[model samples]
Target: MHIMRVIVILFPLLLASSFTDACLAAEVLTLAKDGNAKAVIVLPGGATSAARETGGILADHLKQICGGEFRVIVESDLKDASVKDQRIVTKSTEPVETFILLGEGGLTKLLGATSADLGPGGILIRTFPNAIVLLGPGKTAPSDPYGTRYAVMTFMEDSLGCRFLWPGELGKVVPQRKTIKVAPINFNYTPRIRQRRIRMAMGLGERKSHGVKRLGFTDADYHYFNKAAMVTTSRDGGWANWHRLGGSLRLASGHSFGYMWEKHKDEHPEWFAVQPDGTRDQSRSPDRSRLCVSNLELIEEIARDRIESLNKSDLNSVSIGPNDGGQTSFCRCDECRKLDPPNSRKLAGGGPALTDRYIYFWNEIAKRVTEVHPDAWLTADAYSVYSAPPVLRKLHPNIAIRFVGLTYTNEEKRRQDREDWDAWSKAVKKIYFRPNVLLAGRRQGTPVIYVHKLAEDFRYLASHSLVGTDFDSCCHNWATQGLNYYVCAKLHWNPDLDVDALIDDYCQSGFGSGADAVKSYFLRLEDITNTIAEQQLKITQPFPPAVIDELRGYLDMAAAATADEPDASKRVAFLRSGLEYTDAYVAAFRIFREHEAAGGGRLLKETKQRIREALDNNWLVSRGIFENHHLAVNVATVAWGSWNYFGRYYWSDPSPEIRAKVESR
Candidate 1:
């Protein structure tokens, strides 16, 4: 009676069409009741690859949840279907039969939505009297029409209580039920960030670690997965279901045009930076070869090159920003220096102010490029000495500036970066949060869970014209920092999402009954990450033995509780292996300290043993999106330095055993 009363109140006009039928209106649209199909999944005529794939995803999941073959068909072919039940009910409530529409079609306008209403990456889900309409843009690549796919997923997630915790099939948590029903539903959503990608260098065929030693890697690297598991992890980890996990707009990142030095050095000698000594050579300077942005000829040439590239294929945006370096060089020509402002802010300590010149250069290029491609965007970074806003000029409408930021662990730096982000929002047509702050390369193989700070920062940026985000890198150490990556993605789609609820969902889905133990474990990691008062304190602080033991205790409990659930058990095992690797690194750091103080072969021996254990543990994690070996190969062996525990002895041999083991492959 309450359902009928609410239905009548909500749709007075629809009630007028069928007063008698309204009395017998179906209270719930049943897709599956008592493990039998009641509705058919329908697609519009001439469905694309995206449409078929999305429909299949919906059908597969429904079958998993409620049992019974859910058929997918184009609207035209619906009449020729050979299912058990083909009785189509238009307005009657008795002997119920319904169709689930998946995308824009002829009846979509009447159902109250169209492509125009839901723009790029927008979604609409509505339950009509006879059908449920899932509407979104028809995009085929990089998660377009993903809006439609997301609509189906959203309905299942929000209404039916499902959770996609991590990558691969093991990561899915589907609740089983014999009877699944839906009440009147109307929902709409669009991602806050245009692109929500967390790029992992180790996955997606970046390296090869076939069972034994392979080209450029040891068997320990685990960078490339085994062929059998690779299909699942790579497809999931490498952008196969990127949209379902909230990844959208894939755009190019900025970089300094450093190659111009080699390409134009002999032919166009004047295009390179001029040193203070009036030499235009890159050979002698520490910050070799910054571009001479003031040169009209150079601007014309760069514009011409970009235009030619655009002519070859389609590009959403073009990136031409400065190269990354601690003390990068810039053009010191008279024309360039004249454009520098008096109160130029320094990104590092008392750095050069190249903001005005670079801004002028970007605007000029934008003007020339847009003459032919008006919608094309020019991307650059608000970084280094030129990080401050331009005082001399305004940016063109086609320019998008990605702020180099998010050092939330450093209070002062975080404040400054946030202020600059806000300031740049006013100056540029678009702004994105592109931070190398994950520091995966620098802090290699440690749990750096800045998730709460990330949520806070992302929420702030989403409201301030922040259009997209691309973290510099991910090591795929999912067991330790999985929450950071997962939460970052969830917020990318829904800027105002509840972080606590998201964490609960993840723990519940991945850990099952052991969720409490797993939740305690990750929360402890988050606490440890946020409490580090100084990010740059170079103090060789011991990675507290007590804390390690405490976390291990939680994992042990999780392992016990999840023993019955095979899927949860696997995830717990993955996390435990990661912790072992972290503990090994910690033990090695302590032993190295003792060796430095007392100078003994025994301490060095202990350090090598710990490192060996680290490698052993790394292999287990590598099987599930962990890039521990890739990090060791990149940061530890060749780039070892006194600053890090792993790279303590590079000049001669820090740890003869570890270095030898790492380099031998």
Candidate 2:
């Protein structure tokens, strides 16, 4: 295999002295063997922050490797720079040898370009020897990024040895031409529980958890989470991060979560939700709050605006609506009552009528989105109040219903949890009536609580008829913890994957064969940690101190299991210390719980003292094991305890200073 290397070299002195820095910078980048060198075209269109930063980095790298005069053109300049034959002109007087076309698909379209355009008869005839096209980090048409990039890279390497670099570095390659396998990938609707397990097991990467929220209707916060997903997905090749038109529009414009509904209510004050005293409801932000979907015009206008804006982004898929929680209450205005005659029967305390309106409104929105972006995918979040089996209007075949299952409270509450899932599943079946539904799995409340149920749900969903699922355990709230991200990645790719085996693989990859025994001990430690952090903590009622002691003994047994390892003396010591630490913490938790249950000034003082002691002892143990174990253990301790401690103060009526102290630590 012949590989053509383009070495870009930089002259710092020339750059410093140039008056026309931007233009001169362009001219200085041309290849040394003017006529012998190939023509290179670089173009960048609408870019996300990450894409722009990456472009700048690539440009800098090129400058350093290929020092000389070079002509650089932006995507906007393509039309003006083209000749009668449609070949892009080279500013250099010398004939070009290689051509590099860089930009997103939108910019490429402007150039009247295709992958085949780099061929002999196509445009940029003189620069056919070497041509490379760069995509983007911005939200783009799904097919262009996934299909186009793969196709172009293969074509470029075959036709001209020029490689494409955008997402990141392609490491050392063997010279031999080996056969490659290509698989067809699609996003089918997966069950919610399965999605949660995969995502949780992948562990919190940068923005994975946010991806889950984005999959719901919280578009405003999607970018923050998407950044994290992009980094993690790129590193571990399970799936590529997708950019949708509707999502991109919301992100770029900084639109609020429920902006569409809010805008309508602002124009018509009569559509606002009314309170018992006849005053307009103002529970959340009045300016950008939800509106009554009673008025037909309001719904139409919102649909039109959202559809048009999304179409402009050139995206083909998007998840619609807000975070899946709260009651689906709208308004009990006269127009709403007239539109919904059934409201008369369900209007007890004016609650049912309001709830009915919200369902009607959401179903209408889904209908409109399907109409506008027919080829695009639309996911309606069947979460919170919308989980029940209400009459959903007909939808386009292309639109997929996503059932979002959130387990925040105790997992053992089968009655409530099953009812929630049954309601959502029933509603989805009523509307779509197909097994091709996707489940958006989320574990709300505390991180520890969510992770515990998430694992159990993953196994449960995997046994059912699920198309695909998205996991959201790695969010801003959970990133600080020592969750097993590698395990999560494995589950994402295949939910039936054995987590223990995955952990073993991760340990081997991170630490070589010399540390196999250490890896085995850590894997065992992880199982123990999950058992304590997830399973044991779920019991609703308080346990006796003896029960706590029994749990401590079990942890001690786990520690003892590793004592006989011949090659892991250090691991054995660390395990013993961890067991001691857990024992002390469990004892402290029992005391704190007892005091908390009793309630009062004495209990408050005792709780504070218990926390102080636990923190002090744990901090010391953490320091001692810092060099022996992975950073994950320490990070998990902080992440798991941070929210738990803080929530105790807010939810359990602890002193204000308790939260402050935990936050500071």
Candidate 3:
């Protein structure tokens, strides 16, 4: 009665319509009150993939709540369909007693909302006793159609207490109910950051042990954002651009160096990076790939390949940057060196700063690409030695600079990162962020958790013109840094969100009764990471004996805290994995030291016995973490990589025991 009494000022004339009159005149739509109520999902005839997905998502939840009474109908087809008992309705012009509206047309028609009212990725939700309307941003914005989808997820999470922790059944938490209830409500939300993405590396195959594979695009994994690492057509036929949708049109990354190397290495060796020795260097760089940035012909070749990709799809941008890895892979030829400013940060002998040539090369390439794709963008990374902004010339407006995340634990490096962000923000018109939170290759040691720092960074950068974010992580990092991963996603979506509240929600939802233990565990890990960073110690370096013991003690405490919660064993195991990994490495290093102090015989036998115990514990930890062997495989790689440092002395020996194991492998 109250809702009917209050007329929406702008919609007075529209209320005269039968549908509006019925909606305003009826009491609230009682879903499943008599077990005859049905939710009618109404969609535009040619809706986007996101619209279809969001509609289905809402319908599925209604079915769960209303006990299987729901119907999905395209708006155009609604005329032929029966709706005698339809309670929840979406975007209908016909005079319906109770109706819900979603997206642009519904919001503008029912609530008198203009396109300018909702910015890109913004949503408006208003509720009456009998009706609800969920409005999302315009469809043209890169994140668009998907922005409405995100609104759906946010609604479920905020109102229904649904939590999608990670991909897969284990990570989804949905509340069960026989009847869905709606209360009067009003809320609006807009993402602080435009781009929220995750790039995971390991396997694309259907390996059960691979977390990324298990998570897939949906299956609980895709519950968060719009972009992913791979590209494919959605089931609804709309584009699914995982990495910078409307941007790069490729499944793989770092093509520039590889393409030039493959095309010119044999015939045009000079087109590759020139070593300090005046010889062509194609193999010995941080990225194991380099390019002759000064070669105009080589730039043309790279541009041509990009054009080919653009022709295949209507991608809004392309990446024409250095290969993945540190930026010490630039050419050292005299012509390339001419672009370097004096007092440049040198790489190898008589070479200029990597930034000097990187900007010049990209500027040249951007010029050519802009001529064709004027509205499109060209992306480049400011990483490692080239992390600093260019000193000489400003980047072109068409160029997008991705400021890769640098050291988080170290104070000086953190300051340098902010400096880089500030300088580049001023120099480049478009900016995208790629934060590395992985401990891959030799950097694998103690797991680092920089939750506070990550939140701070996101908040700080949101003030700048940040277009998007792609969080780069290894397989183990994602599982081990579970809390950090959750926090990062929330911050990217809304930088102003209370991070402490998010962290609390994550620990409670993830660990349940054992939340306190898990929360303390991560806090301790962050403390140790900060200490290590402050001491200027690399995680890959061997820990001091006392530090190793302290870490082991923390692991024991975490294990004890979750020991009683057997149901949460998987989560607990994943949480403890990084520590376990570090502990195993420490124990191995200790054995190596013992061997150094004493020759073979009894010491070797005893150490081997201890190592066997450690290995056995590792398998349990692995199963508890990933429920499979991928983490074990990753750990094995770390061990073998460090074998020469210690493992070879014992594991590789020709003695009977070692020889038998080696031969079996």
Q: What RMSD does each model have against the real structure?
A: 6.8, 14.8, 8.5
TM-score of each: 0.79, 0.46, 0.74
Q: Write the per-residue lDDT of candidate 2 for residues 1-665, one digit (tens) a residue.
A: 12111100111122233223322222222233422223444545554444443344333333323332335555555443443333345455656544455544443454444434221111111122123444322223322233223222222332222221111122101111222111111111111221222222334434433332322213333333334323421121222221110111111211124554445445666555554456565445544444555667767765776687677776554544444333434455676655443532232244342324445665676578777666655455544444433443333454445545544333343334445455444344222111111111112111222223344555554444343444343322111122233334334433454454444433332223424553444444334434443353532122344543553454344345445533233323333444444444344455566676777344466576666666555444433333233221332223233324534533322234643554476
Among all candidates shown, the one with the greatest TM-score: 1
Show how many residue pairs clash in every candidate, following the order shown. Answer: 4, 37, 9
**Ten residues in sequence with the least summed lDDT for candidate 1:** 632-641
Give one digit per residue, the lDDT tens place, for model 3 in 208-317: 22322322223233212212322121121121121112222221224355455555678888777777677785654533467777989888877877777667866677
What lDDT does each candidate get?
Answer: 0.64, 0.37, 0.57
Candidate of highest lDDT: 1
- Model 3 poorest 10 in a row by lDDT: 235-244
| Candidates sorted on lDDT, descending | 1, 3, 2
Clashes of 2: 37
Q: Report the Cα lDDT for candidate 2.
A: 0.37
